[model samples]
Target: MAKLNINVRSFSYKKGIPTDPTGNGGGFVFDCRGILNPGRKEEFKTQTGRDEAVIKYLETETKIALFLEGVFQVIDISIEDYIQRGFENLEINFGCTGGQHRSVYSADTTAKYIENKFPEVQVTVQHVVQEEKNWINEAY
Candidate 1:
């Protein structure tokens, strides 16, 4: 049998709950509201987390690093067990007020981390609020 590791979905709370694209429910949800919000600033008001400026602000000026560490620790345990059990579906949603800034960043960060750490897993990331609607799927 082919090994299927993980599937992740990132979305805004405004868009409603993110369901597994493959039809599974009961995934993890992380709220990014606790982190320092960059959206309050005038310059960052129009920007999303994918932008360089927003990235810098979240990484350097906020507690996002530590926040993500805790997120990873919790998710890692679940992911490891999922892989062992031959589970093929997992959904992770990051939610913020606007789903444009903090939530988007958290989703992207988490997806990238899983992709890098567990090459056996397939990772999918979606930014629901962006005009272009970014989607990334990485499989190995």
Candidate 2:
């Protein structure tokens, strides 16, 4: 069986999309900008999507669950096919205003979802804005 490498990412639309490190040019890009932003709220301004408060705001106050349902359905189809086809690389990107809240939330959740659904798949997550800050792996 071919090992499927799924590179999940969060990026800022303003800063542009994250490039595929695997050099496979085509993959999924889901825009998170359409959802209500928590950043506009003073409480969530400094918090990343990984933060409990930001996660709560996004999960309870916005349409993030619905949006992710659609995204997961789409990606699920492709992942099943990719595994069978022995394809090796897949990239999924979520973009929003700052790449701090919405995009990050989606990417992290999607990575976890993919991990649970496709046990053999190798999932890596990157927060581009956070990476630029040199704090990629930390729970910020």
Top of the candidates by TM-score: 2
Which candidate wins on lDDT?
2
Give a tens-digit lDDT track for model 2, residues 35-70.
999988888777789899989999999999999999
Worst 10 contiguous positions by lDDT, candidate 2 = 131-140
Off by over 4 Å in 1: 131-140
What digit string (tens of lDDT, one per residue) describes model 1 on residues 61-86? 99999999999999999888888888
TM-score of each: 0.86, 0.94
lDDT of every predicted structure (CA atoms) = 0.79, 0.91
* CA error at residue 65 for candidate 1, angstroms: 0.7
RMSD value for candidate 1: 5.8
Which residue pairs clash in candidate 1? none
